[model samples]
Target: MISGFKLDWTLISPVYCKLRWYGLQFGVLTSFACTCLAAIDQYMCTNARLEWGQWSTADVAHRLIIIMTITCLLHGVPYLIYFNLVRAPIAGEISCTSDNLAFRQYHTYGYLIILADAPLIMTCIFGLLAHNNVHQLAHRTVPLVNVL
Candidate 1:
């Protein structure tokens, strides 16, 4: 018993496993939040009157679509890669106080984060589609009343 009590591998392993899972969940949540923020900022820039310009409604929608696409590329993609590299492998190996286990859990968290960002990418795709439809409508006829 290295730690004063008889070391129980079965008892400890489950705790480590849970910690690793929780770490993964945390990472996923963090990544999702970052993605959402980027998308929301772009949405606001495009649909809200937060920017300094007297853009026509069509111009606003066009700018928003462009901004959202750029933000997705610039922020979401790298975050996904970074998270995967740092967090994926130790998905169920972390422990409460074990250093090696903790490291693995942390890495597993990084992976989950990247995986979670998939939804944000999808959101960006849909946003682009919606923006394109609006743009086309603007050209062909009266613009939609609400473009967001």
Candidate 2:
């Protein structure tokens, strides 16, 4: 029984090791992509106000404030939840890390919520693309059949 238990751990160890490797890869790539999106949003807002040079400093400031607020709520919070909550827990389990365990538990629920919203986001993106396609076609003439 002791020998079998030891063999089981040996087998399980590799599984956990692979999980940790994949988790870190997933987390890093996801974080980098999100950072790129944040940068893009910042760039877009700046270009709309400063590059155009029509808006006053107050107007630009207000726009930036709104953009930053929305991004923090929509992107930043969810990102932290995904990283410190979902990815970190799985990673910690694999590595047997006790540090940050409390933070991980606190954020676990956010991961559940984030997973639930994934489908909604996909639906919204597809709907937007379909709407845009219809709008583009509206300017073009299509052949129609007439029945007397």
Candidate 3:
């Protein structure tokens, strides 16, 4: 944004155009994946089952975060491939876009619809489960711990 908007630099470079698209998708997809993972983690941590609770450890969370980061970074590779500098039909004005027809469909329906909404739905469901578990904690009997 700063490079393009603030600096008013021309995006004639193919590498810059590709990297810009990749970076945008990477940031968005990674955050969505992490948010869903966090909700799932919270739900697991609040579960009464020992095994479920065991899955919510800091080590597990860190590992999952790293895995998701790599996954999201890789996911943006298609965007980098498909996105490029294109000339408009009207006035021959150059703009960054994908010329691939199938990719355009996927970006519209698959990415914009399914990939985007899936996380929102997952986050809502798991977040509500975690929230309910937290609220019900007071009524449940606490396990007595041996203090040091």
lDDT of 3 by residue, 1-148 (tens): 6555674222477788888888888888888888889889989989878889989889998899889888888888888888888899999988878879998788878888646789989999999998888877745655433332
- For model 2, residues 25-135, the per-residue Cα lDDT tens digits are 345434543444444443443342445434435566567656644543444332223332122445454332223555456445654454445434644554555455555
- What's the TM-score of every candidate structure? 0.32, 0.30, 0.84
lDDT of each: 0.49, 0.44, 0.82
RMSD of each: 14.0, 12.2, 3.9
Ranking by TM-score: 3, 1, 2
Query: Clash totals for all models, in order?
Result: 6, 0, 0
Candidate topping TM-score? 3
Candidate closest to the true structure, highest lDDT: 3
63-127 in candidate 1: lDDT tens per residue?
Answer: 76666555544443322333221223457542333235554575568545556566668568747
Q: After superposition, which runs of candidate 2 have C-alpha atoms over 4 Å from their true positions? A: 1-102, 135-139, 143-148
Comparison by TM-score, 1 against 2, better one: 1
Clashes of 2: 0
Give residue 5's lDDT in candidate 3 (0 to 100): 68
